[model samples]
Target: MYAYTALGGPEVETFLDLPIPEPGPGQVLIRVRAAGVNPVDWKKRTGYRPAGAPVPEVPAVFGGEAAGVVERVGEGVTDLAPGDEVFGQTVTGGYAEYALLPAALTARRPPVVSFEDAATLPIAAATAHDALVQLDLPPGSTLLIIGAGGGVGVAAAQIARRHDLTVIGTASPAKKDFVESLEVVPVEYGEGVADRVRAAAPQGIDAILDLVGGDELETLAALLADRTKLVSAADRATVARLGGAPVERARTRAVLEQVAAWVADGLLNPRVVEVFTLAEARQALRRVEDGHARGKVVITVPA
Candidate 1:
C-alpha cells in the first residue's frame, strides 16, 4: 500500500509499502479509488485544528473524503459487504490504498455517480445542507452565499435554489462565469461585495452563508437583516461570539445517503477542477492550501 502522510510542517511524503489499515468493530475496509482534497486536509497537515487536540501519529494518512469499493467488513457490520461501491468521510486513513470507516458514516454510492463526484459529496455538500436547513429559510426568501464559486459554495447555491430561494453568490472575476452557470447571480467579491448584493436584492438578504471568515465576517454581518439567520460552517466560534448561528453536520450515513441520491438524480453535481495521482499528493494539497481551486481537487489511486 502507498499513502500520503503529513510528517509535520509543509511536507507531505509518499510512503510505499505502507501497512494496510484493518477494519475495527462496526467498521468497513475500503480500497480507495479516489480521495478528495479539502481545505481542512491541508490545514490539519499544517497543525491547524480548533479543538487543539494532539496531532495524530506522525506520518498520519491525510484524507477526509473518499470513494471506493468495500473489500471487507468488520464485526457487526451488516448493511454493507464486499464489492459495494461507497463514499464518505473518514476521521483519518483515507489517503491510503485501504482505509477503515466506521459503518455509521459510510453510504452506498449512487448508481449514476462516478468515483470522482462521489468523493466530493460527504463534507462540502453535507455542511451546506446543514447550514441552509438550520436557518429555516422560507421559500422565495433571498439568500446570499460568500465564496460561492468553491465546492461548498456551489452546493449551497444549488440547494438553496432547489428550495425556491432567490440565490445570490460571490466569486472572483475569473470564476464569475462558472458561478453564474449554476443559476446563481454572481457578484464580484471585493470592496463593494455588499453593495453589489444589495443592488441585485433590494429588500436585503434574508440569510447569509459565510464560507470565508476574517474581514468578510464583519461585512456579512452588516448585510444581515436577521442576525440569527447568518450562519458559518468554517468559523463556529466566531459566529457564536458574534451572535450568529454556527452550522455543523452530524456526518451520519443517512445524511450522506441522501446526498448520494441527489448526485444520482442530477440534482447535485460536484465540480472536479483537478485530479492528481497518489504520488502527486503534495501538489494537490498545495493547490487547495493556496485557495486557487474553483472546486474540489481529487487524488486517484491506481488499481
Candidate 2:
C-alpha cells in the first residue's frame, strides 16, 4: 500500500510503500477509493496533536475519513461483509490505499452518492449536523457561521437554510461569492468584524457556530445577547470562558447516514472543490493548510 506519511512531526510528507494492516476485531479493511482532506490533517502533520491523544508511531499516515469497497471484515462484524461499498470515519488513517475502519462507525454508502461526495461527510458534514442539532435554534431565527467558506461552514450554512434560519457567514474575501451562493449574508472577517455583523443583521444574531478560534471567537461571542448560544469547534477553553460550549459530535454511523440522506435529498452539499491523487497528497494538504479552499478537498486513490 502507498501512503503519504510523516516521520515525526509537521515536516514534508513523503509517499512511501507500507505493508497493509489487517483489521482487528470489530474493524474492517477498506480498499480506499477516496479520502477527504481537512484542516486537522494539516494540523496533525504540522505537530498539532489533540489534547491527551497519544503520539502516533513514526511514519504515521495522514487523513481521518474515506470511502471504498470493503476488502475484508474483522471478527464479529456482521453488518458488513466483503465487497460492501462503505464510507465512514477511519480507524487510523485514510490516506493510504487500504485503511481500517471500525465497523461500528462505518456505514453502507448509498448507491446514489458518489465516492468523492461520500468521502467528505464523515468529518466535516457530520460535525456541521452535530453543531446545528446542539444549537437547536428555532426556524426563522438568525444563525451565524464562522469560517463559512470551508467544508464545515458550507455544510452548516446549507443545513441552517433547511431549518429556515437566517444565515450570516464570515470568510476571507476570496470566498465571498461562494458564501453568498449558499444564501448566507457574507461578512468579511477581521478588524471591526463585530460591527460588520451588526450592520448585516440589525435585529442581531441569535446564535453562533464558530470554526475559527482565538480573539475572533471572543469577538463573535459578543454579537449575541445570550452567550450560551455560542459554540466553537476550535479553541474549547476560550469558548468555555465566554460561556460557550465546544461542538459535541455524535461521531456515529447514524450521523453519517443522516448526512448522506440530506445530500441525497438535495438539502446539503459537501462542495468538494478539489481532488488529488494519492501521490499528490502533499499538494492536497497544502490547499487546506493555507485556508484557501472554498470547500472540501479530497484525494482519490486508484483502484
Q: Which candidate is the best by lDDT?
A: 2
Q: Global CA lDDT of candidate 1, please?
A: 0.82
Which candidate wins on TM-score? 2
Report the lDDT tens digits of candidate 1 across residue range 117-159: 8888888888888888788898999888888888898888888
State each candidate's clash count.
0, 1
lDDT tens digits, residues 97-191, model 2?
A: 99999998899898989999999999999999999999999999999998999999999999999999999999999899999999999999999
Show where candidate 2 strays beyond 4 Å: 1-10
- Model 2 TM: 0.96
Q: lDDT (0-100) at residue 226 of candidate 2?
A: 90
Against the true structure, what is each candidate's TM-score? 0.93, 0.96
Error of 1 at 153 (Å): 0.8
Q: Against the unseen true structure, what C-alpha lDDT does each candidate score?
A: 0.82, 0.89
